[model samples]
Target chain A: MNKYIKLMSFLLLIIVTLTGFGLYKAQASSPYPELKVVTTDGKPEYIEPFHFLGFVSDTQNYSNSSTIVFKDGHSRYMEDQTFLERIDFNYNPQLNDFITDHRSFMRGKSRRTEHYTETEQHVIYTGMESDVYWNQPSRGLMTIAVLNKETEEEETFSVSLGSDGSYYEVSATYVNYPNLTILAATNHSTDISEQFVYTFDVENPTEELTETINLTQEIDSNGGVYFGQSFDRTERFIPIQSVRQTDDSEFDYTEEIIGYFAFDTQMQELIDVPLFEEDTLLFADNDKLYVGKDLGDTIELHEMNADDQNLDLVGSIEMATPTIGREEGTHYNNLFNQNITLLDGRLYAYETQYSDDISRPLFQITDIKTQETLFNGTIEPKDMAKHDSTNIDVFEFRLDTLNN
Target chain B: MKKSLHNFLKFTNFELERLSKFLFALMGITFIANLVGYIYTPMKYMGKINEYIAQNSATSEQAIQQYGPFSFYNALNSFWIVGPIALGISGFIFYSFFIWYREWFGKNTFAYRLLMLPIHRMTLFYSKLVVVFIGIFTLISTQMISLFIGYPIVSAIIENTYYVNQSLMEAVQLHPLFLYLFPLDLGFFLTINAVGLVVLLVLFTAILMERSYAVKGIVLGIIYAVVALTLVLLPLFLPDLLNNHYILYGSELIIIEAILLVIVAVLSLFTSRHLINKKITV
Candidate 1:
């Protein structure tokens, strides 16, 4: 009995001694670390601090309807009236026609179409007028710019536009040595009958072009031409031609997809491959081209040997479950909706489900070699819409092996 | 086999009878402490709010909004509530070692009588483990029942508007420790208890090592403990030794832990049986 009492007291003593040392260490150390704050203009400032919530994916223009509240009892409401007006216009065409008739009362403006071309270093924005007014013809204008993402430095590249027709479309193809930008233009007509193709060097945009391709024969009446990069980093001019047939009535016409032809820049010939509606091109490397297709409940990733153009079967992963709270009457397609990217021999797929109840975003990483799922987890974002549709824009997907 | 089973059951019941008074006292104290916390927290909070209202002429709603409503968070954070849990865990840890030591060190020399029983000595080790297991569940059940009983008394005192009330299951989910003890998933609850059983078995083997070697037994016990812990944790670090390093999934990690626990249990029982039959001083 005495020995039992001694053991009990000794155990209590050890526990108390260890707990006291722990408390002393905790008191000696600072609870919160010092935080460094920087202003938008790269200058440091000491100011009232606020906790940083996570960033929201500003996709589908949902940010316009979002509300931001600060800890200082200040709240800001964002209401995008233009987006509401656009939805209203789509639903009621008669109302749009009535507004268009009263051009003097309404703010009527000519419509312009813009194309965005993105590379690793630069984002090129080009806009062109679609319609010509009475007695006024649209002229072609082109501008080039260099944007450094790391330094946030932007400089306008010197450019000279020819006295030609209005530029309708622009395509950019990046290669190893000299990148090229192709511009297609036509005179004041809706039909692309007599079109001119002009190529410019991306690096030295100021230099005048010594050679021009008179592609009137190459480009058919209803055909579209675009520039793209092949799997081997070779620049190819792809022309998607269409066949048009007149119906019994002179007013009606029918157009069918003939085929897509790739014009090799170096070989100066066409490369032909069978095109299917289900096979959508996802990514291309030097020797292989990755294509994705929907297989009922799962998405199968297939690799096409770009050398021989033979398609081989790859593994598949299950598609995300649908949102529970989607509107009853609304027709929502849940096919090919996930964002998938292949980087460093690994595939990353992100799927977000949004309904009237809750929003959850799931991310998965799979190794391409083993075809095994390496990681699968949910990403929790602050202020996630609990009662509405969510759009998660994945702007960048990178795997940093060094940090891991 | 029938004789062994009968002796095992008899020894387990005897251990329970010996510790019943101590176990009941521990449970009573823990329950009273937690009950006091559950009642005092809301009363103290409402007093502060009333004082604030008297000084500033603030509405009850305004006061509730500014200084948040009485919640399960308040009850969980109360020192009285936490103190009982800490005390229970500490007492149990000490009792686990004491259960084996008491037989050897007691006035009546109980170890000699226990070993002299014409039964498999492994049954004796297992009987003590079963007693400890039953004690743990009883204490947890006592704490849960105390919370259920104390919650209504608190709610009756504090007005519905002044507090955010939760259901029994919701309150259990809100508390981190209670969520594991009374898990919603049956598999998770079983997994947690299985891990606890493995830890108890390891401690039993360490205690047997001490009883076998006497003065040199303390060092041997510590060394045995370190080696057992290292073996159990090898799976977690073994991947790093390979060229193609990969992380395991959650299910795979659980499987590895289960495998290691089995290995530890087998090794512990084997070593403990050898010490009991061959090297034990009694």
Candidate 2:
């Protein structure tokens, strides 16, 4: 039995060894890894304009088949990542789309107005204005429309540009003022306050650069002053044909501002003022004084009385930054910090309240000098269609008409 | 014999680096794997030897049967353990080749032939056996030391004695014995491993003796192995063929295994003896 056992034991070892050898020959285990491509910013911005969350398909086919998403109530678009020629669409279908089957969705029926700022560049959809819509309406679909900046002949629609250069249709059609003048404001949208968009009659161009805040002013002794907005924008701001040339051009395009003025009424005067932190991004002349305070909530107006450091707690109200597009315009107020601005003897305050979809009221136009409301209404946020997640210049709008 | 043993000691005394190398490799690889495994895929990484206990940690008897620390040690000490491992199967192959070509037995080549040796045939056998056994000794002792150092090595990283204790205790629970001793159980395992070489040696002896054709000797050895396999199968496979409902418990299976090992050791030694003493003719 022992001999038999010995013999058998020998055989089993051979089997195990052969198996081990086979395994060794076969090779050990491993888990090879791979990589993915992603783009960081893709919302409406100033330089190159399109609707919010809007990118034309690929620039290769900018006129046809490319669509934009504007933020409106009860709407969202989800498509697998695909190649697009001009991917952005307008908030108002009437502007970009015609009655359904009558027009092949491929060749959308609207007159093609906005061509790509750069030919053959792929247009991506970025969701810039969607969040603003979500902030306002809280829930429910809001309509946001997009129009080629060049097609905007007059007060065409309620609009707000995205981080990407695209105009998103907002549900607001603020009582369309022929000319707007934003003197001062606080407590408003995250984007720059565009109280005015002055047109330069000569230059014809298109671009997208979203976030912008432009103003020029002077102050007096008691923090009382009148300042007019220069309906100015960069990227979309056209320099006069002569001004668009070079830095040394005859027409000075140093910092494009068509019209600006500060009335000498409620003026605060000081010999000289403390310079702000060079690093500190000054949103406006008033913003330099409004530091460390929660500006996201409300835009505060204060008195720069002599040495009264705390900007002499001059009465502060809300200010609203207005958006425009194809829809009529309006405004909204915030629940927390309000955008407070003093314009033309009136305090235009806006308190933005956010929801799943945003639809804010325009500034509460109250006269600070007389304490009366000149205009108070909700402003239009971009419809869901104008939203994009990738394109950064959503606010880049073009001018079809110039002012006298 | 004492001189032989001394020489053997001297031979292995310098082997610490090699042993340490194997142990280091074993341990380093294990530690890294354990570390990565603990971080990435803990379930696949750790304490696998203690699986029986892991699945039934709540159970008492089954837990005690595991050899957890040894498995864990084997993993971490692979760097050091690899050297000793080279002396195992590869060593056997090398030694077999040496013995085959050298005809250190019947009639090949070697300075210390049984005829030329100034000692009895058995003395030479005992000497070689001692050397081989010493190799086995170093292998097992290194394993034990590695198993011991595993805690300290792991502690360097974790700095948690309680966790170490828990892990070590679980490792211990997996296997009841602290050490697997030689010349009996362990010795049996090695001898069983050497049986194929023994059968070859026997044929080699038959070649020198010309008692049968050298090729016939190989054929006979193969036939013997097949016959033996049939006998072993009678109890395992034939029982099923007979349809008898016999069952074995844990201890009984272990005892049977032990017997089998002992049988291989005796048979291999017996064959070695015959090969050593066989008369050389051609």
Candidate 3:
């Protein structure tokens, strides 16, 4: 031992220092202080089962971000010491599907919800494959993969887009057992884009039928079109919106919704939906479509009329425009797209409301039918001192249905 | 089996002793540089902020708003922070070659005595590999200590008002390069180190090839390294090469990669053992 003193001492130093550091880090548990959603008013049980997960980014250095989870009235770090552990914390079925199944993995994470759909009998994935080089004549092909859930077999095929125009995007996909419907937006050489609904058989996908929605005839050439939220695979209708940019100047511009049409996948026709006010928020969950108008003190939600396809008054819920500290100019707000999430007839509206005086993640859940505010709260640190150390706020939220 | 195990341990300790001075010097350089970075970077920032306040007649709040809050991550960006990192990396790389070559070229051609030992020649290979692995973890441990010591000192130097407290996890998130080298996640850390170990094995095998074949051996060594690296990187290229739109899942890709790593590692070790035992003319 004396002869090997140098080796022993060096080994001891490495082991002790590393072990101590590991124990300290492990004991610390989290970098940010523990946070909890303290309900100031309304029923807390409404949001008791749901876990809101999002990232808290440093406003000063946007690059530095941490995953935060608000659940069971308390907030914790979503990302832990391991990759699999972090995945387990914010578990998404789509993400889980991607890992477990090769077909989902090939379709990619971004399109896991929109361009992919799964039924009890069949799982389907679609994407637009186009030549990336702009100078060359682009060959756009619709790539499709269908998996039979019962047999555990997958059939993959691609159909060409006729060499006329490049189909750059597949916006929405719907699975109806034997038939798989895909809504793709194509960009032509003349700077005019077109939307086409491509329907295919799951067994023989090469046999394709495409219908081009004449958007050029209905709306202005300069306007852009997009599909509303179609998260559910069984959704029958995809709400399409065409908006033209109204530019007052180089900096000031607003998009005006010129045309709102619902593309019924079963009927194979576009039904015109009456356009609401320009500022109305449009979101669709499953087959039901709703437009929300923020009226300062209350948010008025109007659902689509089942018979006429016109938006009818559903009900208005109580809500206040979130403000920062008393010093108004020292705060920032970044509301995510489709901030209002309607799940099981319950509206979950959330956004990061930040201020130097009080930074909190504010969320309010309302029962759509009863027009009653079920849960209203702000996520904050247990200790005010903890809040001062790290400027933490939730950037997004999801219901804990997937984990359950 | 007991005798071989004993010889391996003895050789590992001997190799570790041989590299102790170099490793310690690197560790000291890393500690001092990181420590200075933690202190100097923030002090410099505070000086600039004070200068700004004096020049603009602005409050500390306004200055903080403009420059942003100073955190441990700010120190990470300083040029001084990379000194130890660069030294440690280059030292290990240079030593990987020198570890084998020195046995042949050093006083009394030490390779002859080492190979002539009663124990298996592969023990020498395993021992050198172990020392390299030890030296890397030692440097990592030293860096961890530096952070533990430096974070509080920096908090004091910058003062609580200006200092933005961040967890080590948050620090790594901000600077991704640290997460790759010194991952907090045990699985990730092991995976990264496993890759490093395989890479070292390949390099050692390449060095042995040079020792065995002389002039012709240099080209063979380069080819051998290229083949090993290509096999390791095959998983990444397979999707693109086959034009199959990433048909492989994450877990499958990882499994394939792990298998390839094991294969490359085993082949390198076996080839090295054969070269050192039979082919080398010492």
Candidate 4:
């Protein structure tokens, strides 16, 4: 019994201490006030059950910062999420089941979400890799891995792009069975970046075709090419934008859109996409691509038809043109700070609306095809008395899509 | 089964008794070192801040601007706070091998006597495993409990104006090294501790292998360790080797890796049991 005393005491100590700590940790509440989006004008059903329009708090300190996700008329903090929910925050559990384990560590495509695609019979992962040697030309290689869903057989293919540059960024991947396509943007030692579409036969590993998407002749001095931000598996066209420096200052140069085009995935060719107006924003939603032009009072949406190489009128969404500068020298109008996104036949515009006295973070969801403003709401603290809007940095408030 | 369970508990207690002195010493070291850290960190910070204020004719705020507010995280990063932690980790790691070796090499060659006891040989293994686990948990609990006691002492020592109020969780969150050791997330905690358990099992198996065989057994033991490690980590590197791609999802990979570790751990236990029962010589 005496011999057991020390062991029993130690065990009891460990169990009690850790249990108390665990309970304390579990019971601890976040100091930040809970915030929820209050829908004033429209139905809450407009915000999808699974889908959420959320803002990551930009509090100066880590302790005060939180992620507020608004869905179904209720707001949830990321910290309050369960273990599975926290895991789901990065990758959907069902999607994660089929997706590659090392997606986060993929070379040059770590930040990209479109590096993997699932076809009817195949699951594919593709990325660009480069090996840089000291005082020598770096070799760029296209890395692709294809898995047959039926047979459960997998094959890896690597295509060399000669000794051009060290850094290659793979933005998106598409699999059309044997034909695997990748969009790679390469940056060279000359401070210039070029985009290319590399097509390879997954069945026959040797054959490769590379098409230069960004033509040097088309790009005038101080001009660079950029692809659209959205990547959809079903979309057959990639939005292309050519920009040139409008202001010539070396450090503080402003870029202006010089050209717009849609690169057809099926045809392997580029078709001119007519811009609705200057400063037009392009977003790809599922199979349809839309161009949005922010007018003072409304944002006009124009659908880009790749077959016709022209623009078709979609619909106009009514929104107040934010004032040019600060409201009474207190709040700056940063309404169009984020890209107006078109997702799943809906248009979402999230902005922190600033006024003379108060700044309200708000979101508007509209049916893109119908142009009907579905839901209009402002994010506010549930306990309004505890809300300190000043502590919220409006500039740092980012509205991110919860999951793709 | 009941007798084995009783014997297992008694053996576990005996194992605890053997390591109790060293465990107590580790706790004492952790306490004194962290206490020194809590005292010295702020005093040195103030000493420098005050000197700067006097030299430059600056306010505390300006000096604080130069050197950030004295947060508990500042003490957390100090050597005094982390040194004993490192020592404790190294101590346990060393003892993991020594715990087995000391019985064979001790004055009377106690391994034969321990084996002769009226109990299943597997009880010896389970008892040692539990003792090591208890020792580690005790150290972890001590560190956490000490932090609860020390944070207020640190705050009291530093001037209220200059000190940054941070909870223990916040301080841990701020320090990446400590966060890895003491993760807030349950998933991470479970995953890390499971990996640690697998490591301890592998180490135990290797020690038993060396004990069972002679000089040539050292090489055999090394091979065994390499094979065990490769088997446990095969799920992680399997896709890369086989297909040159990540075939499994993160959760699937984690699940497979866990299963592989369990398999390897069971194999190690069986192998060690066989060695202790048959192959080991005094």
Candidate 5:
């Protein structure tokens, strides 16, 4: 009995001692760095810090996305890790069907004059304004319809304009005649709103005038037109396209190719810029467009004039090669996408690497012109152990200015 | 061999009869604790919400809508729900060690009597193991049954309008312990139980070692336990270490874990059988 009491007491002491040691170790090894902010005592500021903005999207699910913008050096040491904005691109098929059905009703009533040209083979339609319809109180839904004058086969595409009118852009591409009406509406509803339609005649351009009157203006001139060009004027325009691969497989994937376009909002004209399919828009500052292309181990950068739309070859930076693995010894390899942002003339590229374990962000920053790397590191969140599965695919990184 | 099998069954029955009162006490205590917690927590919130409504007439509807109803989810947050689980787990852990030590201690010296039985010495070890396993399962089953009884009692106390009622299965998921122990997946539940059995076997072997050689066996038991624990955890970390990077797919990881679980269970049971038959002191 005495031995039993002694054994129990000894075990209790060991447990208590170990627990104390663990707590002490935890207190000593803090995850976050100590922050020291320089405060001004009623003094005037001299130079303002540049703010960076970018977004991260789940490559697996494009709708599960977040937009983050932080000031230089603020986020690196801050305790509150909440993003500036988090957007879940929730796909509402019912809302989309509703918008598509009512789109002709909305667009047919628009007062904007329609422009058309006729060719020997095809009748080309251009500059037909469509009204944006908001069914839900928050999200603005807009559908654009393209009709083949020969077959009368109409194809419609819907764009979700967030509460802010600047969320998405309307773009149409003509491939051939049943294949001719390739109406693509890319949802770039993060920062800019500019619409563009690329039209090409397969044979000879033919003109046939079909009268479609703008009835909303006729019905009530005071009623507002919801779609077309953004109501607010902005200097920057970014057009992003999510290219979907139609290969018959379990993993239906979409890759985003961010394109840069300079729009004269007043003239309603898109400056025709030579955009390569591989080129992804990084950042635009001081009339200069920075674009990046993934070359496996490195990212090739190109500088283009935003005004004249001319491309200049900039140097490339080497990136960390992401380790790829097959799911259950299958042929399909995992998807990896990179997001880039420019701050203080340095380009910050974040690559979200996904595997069986939790997905973590790998970042590398470099000088835009010289292509010299400034810093390369990974941010390990404290709560990484909590998530046991790979659910997150997209992550956006941005920099925003601090309020004085 | 036939006589030994009969003795094993008889000893297991005797152990169960001896443990019946203790098991009942544990269940009764946990049941009362959970019942109080399920009733008290929501009633306290309802009282506070009602008081707020009385003071503020303008926002009464909104306040009632937000906080008036007590739910099974709300009851899950109560100490009674979590406390019983904690108690059961702690008690099981204590009894795992005590189940072996109790035979060596006390006036009768039950270990000597147990060893002197006409059955094989391993039969004695197996009987003790069966008792502990039965005890653990009983506690888990009792907690589950208690939850079903507590659910309706909580619903009756709180108004239906205020509470967002969930089904019994949903309520089980809301509670952390119930979610882990009573998993919807049969394979996952079996896997967890298999791992638990491995742990019990390893512990039993360690105790037998300590009983054999006293102070010298303490060092041996510690080393044995550490090695066993490392072997059990090797599958989780081995692939990454070998490949020089993390690339194991989820399905591959599951397969690795299953293989490791089988290996560990076999090793633990084999070691315990050896220790009981050869090394253990009477």
Candidate 6:
């Protein structure tokens, strides 16, 4: 019986570990998976569940810097840097959240945040994190798993950053089962003349290579620059986030995640209007897109469509930015972050920013074209939380969505 | 009757003093930690408040005008957890010490057999319980005294702890004795909890004295402990007693504790009386 008990204990340990590892292979993880669990919306082409569902395949290798030994006695992994890694066992058993740094070097002082909300059902695991070297950004990546944990499934898609100092962010997700995983910002840059990059599958080895073109256009000057995800020409110029360098002169570059309330790349693109406070997105009676922005006082709404030819001339609704100031420095600075939303068939816009007393996400909806107030209301910033993305500061302010 | 009463008084005093000695030594550590908290908490709160003002660029005039006095209410609440932690550890340590005492007191050695001389064994039981109660009293008092010295000074460091406005000082002053008194009351119930505990201790002691082997003592101790727990649990788990307690509030824990005590005492009397009467070559 003693021997049997020992054997059963050993088997339980093995099964639990194997179950975790098997799940790991299916969830495409980032360098910091604790950070990655926050994404719920799928990005364009990156799709939902960026794990195993793509066409091409490739493998990269890296060395283990720490002499840490695994319980399995296996000391290495399939050296892909972009694969998101969980902090070495610092994750908690009950909460399934990162609790500490597992690496011996990071003992005592933890550099990672532990608690995160999974807005959608996408899986990501951390692979590793390294200190910034020379002028390079901190090295990390998502280990894209091609299978789903629930379905025992297999997928064909696998891709990686083509250049150094470039990274992908999985930003949003949908709540439904077999949830979609989205990817934002690939390492590849775009040239206007050349539209796509082509590559062939590794196993199947198709005769022809695949093509990818990241098409983006800059629209206005709000100091908050953005990139548009939609291919629809009329809605091409919305803003999401303003990128600021960590250090002006250093050789290193790392993406600092901040909050983005007004950063929507396609929010103002279709309407040719600045997304003022209290602008709303509407589907219209004909199912054409419409948006509103509070210009000065009376709000304006613009009739919008995805058609490229007549995109600019779509008439707009008009509104105003409320001229209210603080009565005793007690009020918050309600400025900067903007939201242009199209819920159902109506368009709305809102503004929320930061102050000492109050710093959170809140916005309004207005007319699409004229920056006019169709109506004004505040939606909790967390409510309008972007799909599948953790750092709303980078892509959240820019990505466009039809509110579900 | 008078002789038995006299013997009980002597037995209870001796045992209670020994328990106090152990508990008093433990409180020496509690007092030091509490003193450290009193000095350290104010300094830490001031540091956080200073950082907040400096980073946000605020002045003293602005702070007083904007909020109120410098009172670290949140920081004050942080140190309050120490009292409970100290009390809990002390309680466990005290219980373990008593278990050891029970074992040592039962052997056919100089101490155990001496106490059994011309004594109603009930006197010995009351002595052990009084000792436990004394130890609990000393430990609880040390914890409360420490927190009383710390909370006010820490609260004063925040802009407005509002505790002062809410009559916190007066409340603390009027009820300082209750701080030690409440836990001491729980300690009484806790000491009473040891009735079955004493039986297991005595049973382990008896078996160990007879058997010269190490396994007998440990194995017997474990078995006795388990049996004691089950017996003590009977009244709590009995369908009728449970119904009275849970549904009707018609029964009291003392009644349950008394029944268990009586059974253990009866068994202990018979075994000890037989063991004393039987001739054993020491």
**Candidate with best DockQ:** 3
- RMSD each, Å: 25.2, 29.3, 5.3, 7.6, 25.2, 21.3
Cα distance off (Å), candidate 3, residue B2: 3.0
How would the docking of model 1 be graded?
Answer: incorrect
Q: For candidate 2, give the DockQ.
A: 0.01
Worst 10 residues of 1 chain B by lDDT: B241-250
TM-scores for the candidates: 0.46, 0.26, 0.82, 0.70, 0.45, 0.34
Best by TM-score: 3
Candidate 5 per-residue lDDT, tens place, A59-141, comes to 32222233333234333311122111011111222212222333332232222212221222333333222222222232334
**lDDT (10s digit) by residue, model 1, range A305-401:** 5456676778775533322111122111111112445544555555544544344444555666676655554433333343123332222222222
The true-versus-predicted C-alpha distance at residue A168 of model 3, in Å, is 4.6
Candidate 6 residue-wise lDDT, A1-404, digit = tens: 44234224333544554344334434533221111211122122211111110011111101101111111111122122111232222222212121221222222222222111122222222111221112235333332222233453434333433336544333221111222222233334532121111222324533222333231233222222333222111222232333333544568544421312122222222233233345322222223443434444443445544443132334444322342110112101111222343433334333333333222222333334444443342211232222112111111232122111
Write model 2 residue lDDT over A294-356, tens digit each, in one string: 233333344443334445443433333322111221222100111332222334333333334
Mind giving the per-residue lDDT tens digits that candidate 2 earns over B132-198?
A: 3334444444344444455455544332311222244224222323212222223333434455434
Cα lDDT of model 1 by residue, B24-54, tens digit: 7888888888888888888888888998889
Candidate 3 residue-wise lDDT at A99: 48
> A24 in model 6: Cα distance from truth in Å?
48
**Residue A336 deviation, candidate 3, in Å?**
12
**Candidate lDDT (C-alpha), each:** 0.52, 0.31, 0.69, 0.67, 0.49, 0.36
State, as a TM-score between 0 and 1, how close model 2 is to the true structure: 0.26
Q: Worst ten-residue run, lDDT, model 4 chain A?
A: A325-334
**Residue lDDT tens for model 4, B188-280:** 788889889988988888888788888877888899889988887777766545443334445666777889888888888888888888998
Tens-digit lDDT track of model 4 for A152-256 = 777777777655556666666666567766776565644676666777777677734465555433444356666664423445666666767565676676666
Question: How many pairs in model 6 have backbone atoms within 3 A of each other, for residues 3 or more apart or on separate chains, i.e. clashes?
Answer: 140
True contacts kept of 2: 0.00
Q: Please give me the total number of clashing residue pairs in predicted model 5.
A: 24
Q: Report the C-alpha lDDT of model 3 over B55-100, residue by residue, as the tens digit.
A: 9999989999878888887787677676787788889999998889
